[model samples]
Target chain A: MLEKNKNLLDIKKLKVSFFTEEGEIRAVNNVNFSIPNGKIMAVVGESGCGKSVTAYSILRLIQKPGKIMDGEIIFHPADDKPLDILKLGEKSDELYKIRGGKISMIFQEPMTALSPVHTIGNQICEAILIHQDVTKIEARKNAADMLAKVGIPNAKNRLDHYPFEMSGGMRQRVVIAMAMVCHPQLLIADEPTTALDVTIQAQILKLMKDLQKDLNMSILLITHNLGVVAQVADEVAVMYLGRIVERSDVRTIMKNPRHPYTIGLLKSLPSLSMEKTELPSIKGSVPSLTDIPNGCPFHPRCPYYKPKVCDAGNPPDLNAVDDNHDVACFRTSQIQNEIAGKERCRL
Target chain B: MNENIKNITSTPLLQVKGLCKYFPVFSKGFFKKQIGVVKASDNINFNLVTGETLGLVGESGSGKTTTGRAILRAITPTAGEVILNYKNELIDLTKISHKKLKQLRPFMQMIFQDPFSSLNPRMTVQDIIAEPLVIHKMAKGSVLEDRVIQIMKKVGLKPEHKSRYPHAFSGGQRQRIGIARALIMNPALIVCDEAVSALDVSVQAQVINLLSDLQQEFGLTYIFIAHDLSVVKHICDRVAVMYAGKIVELAKTNEIFENPLHPYTKALLSAIPSPDPDKPMNMNISGEVADPGNLPPGCAFAPRCEFCVQQCEQQIPKLKHLADDRYVACHRSWNVEDSP
Candidate 1:
């Protein structure tokens, strides 16, 4: 029932696994989501939840020992026919053009992304030269313009400054400038502002939001901070142990979460609005990938764990709970009934 | 070891006055000429009451960690007095000898941030927790092991996992082991330096709750140092907001959150992105943190503060008592409007 042109990227039954020495680590299992054109979609989760791995699979950036077993990553450009990114050859020019020209990704660490030896101007100009047919001088000018647009003061002189010469916030701004210099259609930002201070983080988030609007680009934002998602994202998907447990608009997901894991996560976050002596914590920590329990990965830490119902059968699928909200819990109906009963008893 | 010492709670458990720690910077040459000094902690003054948690909130390089280390005597301060109430007598930790400090080490312990790196990966959990008891000669072979198990159980770790190395445990479990190590000595004051910042969200909640529970059960005092205001609000009774080696604001937790006076404190509070979609993110202050090596002549935050005036740019402000139990270091605090 979904329209073809509305979604810029669609991930269908994507299954990614890492074959380690011990065994197969199910990094991403049967994940499904879509990034609509010009929309900011956030994938929120804790560590080892496969959110980064799922984002890495979109641009075919998964390295050796990790295989995209089966799935289709369809990309719909404005003027061209839809193409499956996963089916493209590794070294093909089509993939190369799409990698930086049509789609760009920013990593978690800005220091690692930019080379310390090369000047920032050289680094950013290199990105522009590879994707477009521009002269060296033109690329240099474009780099300065992009840097200025990202709120870097004295962008012209900053061209000669190395990555080490700038602060953490400045280096992050340089990374964003490199990612957005080519004006790509889809931007994948993974924990973009996690390393920065709170003031710097606000500036960067505002920069990203402004850039997204100016360029009319779609963003697949991956982060562990729900506050950032609430501030910027339009859609939210909560990931746990390689599966999308819940998906809805940001308001609905934050206000009326259906999954038990989502509820626990919201409750556990310390808020500034109220001071609490004891925060309601989830029972246990996230299990390692190799030692994940069977039948619903979150069941071990879930508070509403039943003996045979939640811990039995295969993991539930992402079923439609409402008109737009989706939840991957078999006990959604039971949990709702229990909540209603509690309300009646209180009344 | 003595039950009578616990009943006396007349005075503050710890008093830090004019604490300053400076590190000399050298020029890049063969001679290594002295260039300048980085005033990491300068004139830090506070009195921590008995069994109360005092939070030290600041950004990176704001000298919160240095202040914590100076109070514990882990690093020698440039000049200051860290007075602690021990055995119904006041003792200055800074003026003590190395051997004397070692004897007093068990009374004050620290829990570092990064649980993965804080614990000894080569040693088992039991050995790590019992090393304190062994060094102090408090217990022998079996008794030491028993004490370790008891503390581990108190911190919510299973006794069966005592023999496992740190590499086998999860992040949250490893943090529990860290807590057990800090709690084994029954220290009167515990310095938690971003103890819960490295954990996941759910695991962070667990550790925060565990810390409060331990504080209540033992009547322990804490100097909680972190940049996460939400966690500080939940756990701290009072908070001291540090900026550029200065205590910009010190107030009760509720007052600091609801009615911050200093410009830096207000900016920090507004900068926090709340986990609610209804609230929009707004940051009026701009620019990066001031450099400690070459701070401005006036207020260090004048370059980034939105409410900057000529006085703020020319003269530094002192931490003055504004109202009931509220201290703020701002030139225009008297004229600044209330929070919107």
Candidate 2:
């Protein structure tokens, strides 16, 4: 019971910023969340909402001009001491060991993620060889086994094929095999199935779920599709303009979203059941990072935008509204009362 | 309500019969032998009435865009008959000469998928929207600018931003620019091929509402081609499900969603992850989409279908009309419930 309640990773007060000629762009602002051991947590947001930046900060992969301004990423390994990943030096061997051995990432485009010159067998074997002290022949055998585990038919024969020779679905499977070959504790999949067809998307999603359960690994899935979030994620974090607006279990969040941004996102989605003539859309678009709104970033487009209360003060911090459900909204109590009042009226 | 009833009984605006588009592939060498053909559009048949939207949905290589382009004569089809009802006269678009087609271009237009590459970066927004008008000698000078501004405002763009280039606008605003360009000609039929696929969901809803409003105000017909099922369902009146260059099913929007007959259609519908967690998705269909250049014998979906029989492997099923205008192309679609 104690093991089930342990967190694999904890991110607190993370702030990532990009310095450009214009000004400092706050890509990820004070985001806080924790992934429980052997669970799937999804960060849901639209483009330019800084979900990708938060994922990159976990691996310390922020490039030039983009700096991790302030944060504490506490990684709780099963058998080792909890290490603050941000405190590790740029060239520390411990960081290298944790980057790909303890944690690995899978990108959206499989073709670009893989090397075209080398065979897939060599790519997968390289990952295994880097972390494990094994013979070349043993690494090859392990690569073939991993390929077969990912549902690749004729895995042994297909090892010699280059990345370009395989189809999109097959290449994605190879990417997954490479990411999972080292038996990492945490897997960061950034829109992993966005480039594939819907049928193939379903197949890849099912395979990922099966592998996650079998291997006992946590996944930080970053995606914009609400449907995908509902289908896979155990918990969800709604991000808007670098802030974690809401966080809760999947059922609680999807059934009764608290934040106005979350409500707008859910209402905007076109579902199979709801076919109204006019889908009520959130007004305006996501503001540019450089020109973010003063107080709340979502104030410009939020339907419940109050006059000075919402646009003149500092952004609201995340607060608990229910068990394990948190919302960053100043009007949470008022909204709750309004909803209860409407329900009573209906009855 | 009476207007919708009239639209149902009205004559079709466009009729596509036996459309087939094939691109040849040659071997690499001195002796270039014609190896095979990519059947992009294989015997497609559909009809579009006025003030109605017909959705063409499929995967990436399922020939949704090819059918849209072939209908507009953007690419010459290998063999087909595209008959357009122009001013109470039936005119065959494929048989018409190039000069004659140019004159008829004003009635039909197309909105491309990518707003970034589709619009010219060098041209200002005003010029980009007015290029169609300028080419057809419809308007000029201040009159053209006035028309452009009017259409831009209708699509929810500001008049002062007309002189700015596409790079200055957001993705949603750029898509609105693309829509304004397609609507400036006052076209009767617009082939919107994945128009809103590139925008974010919030912007997608805004554009969809704008499109619905435009359709009602102008009485326009749309051949809406896309892969997103939920978006397609919300906007389209009828839907035709395509697979491997062939439409396997064509029916009303609600019928296709509620009572899907084809195995591929069922898999496609089930594959769409619902926003609700209570309804868990169980998509059992396996294997990738079939290669269009080298399709197998009989039904192209036979290899992946769970309900495939020996007869399916031997004979290709013709699209037969089921009850209430629902057409299905499966040998055993009628008995899917019993078999499964």
List each candidate's DockQ score: 0.80, 0.83
lDDT of 1 by residue, B1-340 (tens): 1133245435778989999999999999799999999999999999887778899999888999999999998999999999999977899999999999999999999999999899988999999999998888999888888888899899999999999999999898998998899999999999999999989998999999999989889988899999999999999988999999989999989999998888888889888877888999877878998889889999999999878889999999999987866899998887886534
Clashing pairs in 1: none
Q: Candidate 2: global Cα-lDDT? A: 0.92
> What TM-score would chain B receive for each of the candidates shown?
0.96, 0.97
Q: Across residues B28-116, which tens digit of lDDT does each residue of candidate 2 receive?
A: 99999999999988999988888889999999889999999999899998999999999889999989999999989989999989989
In terms of DockQ, the best-performing candidate is 2
Point out the worst 10-residue segment of candidate 1 chain A by lDDT.
A1-10
TM-score of chain A of each: 0.97, 0.97
Off by over 4 Å in 1: A1-4, B1-10, B338-340
lDDT of 2 by residue, A151-218 (tens): 99999998999999888999999999999999999999999999999999999999999999999999
The lDDT values for all models are 0.91, 0.92
Q: Estimate each model's TM-score.
A: 0.97, 0.98
The regions of model 2 sitting more than 4 angstroms off are A1-5, A342-347, B1-10
Model 1 earns a TM-score of: 0.97
